[model samples]
Target: MGALALVSAVGLAVDDRILVGVPIWAKPFKFSVSFVAYSLSLAWMLSLLPRGRRAGWWAGTVIAVASAVEMALITLQVVRGTQSHFNRATPFDDTVFQIMGGTVVVLWLGALVVSLLLLRARILDRAMAWTVRLSSLIALAGAAVGFLMVRPTPEQLATDDSPIVGAHGVGVPDGGPSMPVTGWATTGGDLRVAHFFGMHALQLLPLVLLVLAALAARSVRHPRFPLLARLADERVRLRLALTASAVYAAVFVLLTWQALRGQALSAPDGATLAGAGAIVLLGAAATTLSLRTPLP
Candidate 1:
């Protein structure tokens, strides 16, 4: 899947035509990178699960095929010199869009099944298990953000000539002023911020625990490291992962809230700041309690 995406990206880049406001190749290029990332992350996560390897493989296969179908449709639309998403400009385009949407739903359902399997099984390391479970849930939450983009905002319905419902930017129409490269909104709310953060939680949460585990291992030999260096026990590491996961989930929710309110990522008001502070305080309290409590 990753290889196919890479090939498609290279092909698109060489084409070098502009579509809508950006390069025609940009959509495939971005999707390729995302597909590679998601594929690698899912593969690594499934490898960590105990038992159900066959089931995991089936689920992973479904996800890969569905994602490839989505990428293929997007690339096909790009080649046709038309919009891939929220585009019902013609009957054929509408059919393609529906197919892509259905593929995404299949991918999401496959992920949910794998997550359920991971949650029910016992892995070798408690910390790693918690990380897998938490990351799966977070990633799923991130995928849910796509629905916001799929459904048209009230502004879009009132403004767009077509019956198609789609808009990426909140409080402003899509394709307005956007951030460089990512093209996320710079003047209004962009749900992609939360979506991006949420999608990578699978990689990020495990990475945090892996780093902490490495540090703790090193401290055992050196003995002069910081307080967290002493957290060599599986239970201690699990607690830490849980605490960090809680904080991470809170930030994801906060970003979604901020975007829904039509506030740009760069322009948070005092109230937003206050809300962030509260989330931090609550996370800190939870972490402290986790550290103090004894495991059964």
Candidate 2:
């Protein structure tokens, strides 16, 4: 699953049409590698669920189906050498992307939520319970941020030309607003920045939570170390710190580069920066809190 996702992401990056008029050959390659790494990590996680839980299996299936659709759509774009990014071709295309994306997110959210609920029900071990709860928190936060970023609105589909009619040459020019900034209280570029950071939160939040879960599990198995022992567990702390910090730093740098390169920074740019900063701080806080709280 990771390998496939990586391939799709890379296909997305390299495609010139996705970048709103700018074309870069190497961009796709970069996306390809990055996406592969991220997807593999996610795949590794989905593989860890117990086989006995019917709900978990179903959730995994849903996620798999959604992911497959996403990959196929993106792959088609890459293979056809067409620009399907953001549904540039047709409204349905973009809608499909959103639906698939949302489905994947929702399924994962459901799984995480269910896991936590089960843990609370005492159907899971201490370490497992803590892991699911923390994971659900992160997943919920990510979903909230993502919904904000891609919330369906008039602005997102605002178009000067009727996408359907224009293709057949039966529509007026300058039909309506194209990608309006009204959905969010900021400029287009700023919103873009906010969206970028928010969407990626899907990755960072889970990574931290899962890593913490792994550490706490190890501590629980050790007879000498108890609750505080888990808290003082340097291995987990170091891993969490390094993973979160590295990912955040890299994303921050890339976002800055993208913004600067596009020269899209304006008054709202400050707002974008603030949004991204908030996300970073939120992730950091969540990780810190989870680590600080000893396993029960």
RMSD of each: 2.2, 9.5
Best by TM-score: 1
Q: lDDT tens digits, residues 1-296, model 1?
A: 56666766686668777765567777777778877888888999888777898999999999999998998898788878889989887889999999999998999999998899899879888888888899999999999898888887786667756746787778977777777788778789999899889988988898999898987788788787556554776777888899899889989998999998888888898878988999889888877776666466
**Where in model 2 is the C-alpha error above 4 Å?**
1-52, 88-128, 144-161, 164-230, 233-296
- The residue-by-residue lDDT of candidate 2 on 1-296, one tens digit each, is 44654554564465545332233222344334544544454454444545435665565566556555655565555565544433445665666556656765765565564445444444233433334344444444433433433333343347464232111001211112223321111222323353345335446555655666565666677757665355446554544544464445445444544343322433335655776677677778766765565433
Ten contiguous residues with the weakest lDDT in model 1: 225-234
lDDT of each: 0.84, 0.46
Please list the residue runs of candidate 1 whose C-alpha ends up more than 4 Å from where it truly belongs after superposition: 4-16, 159-164, 226-228, 285-296
TM-scores, all candidates, are 0.91, 0.48
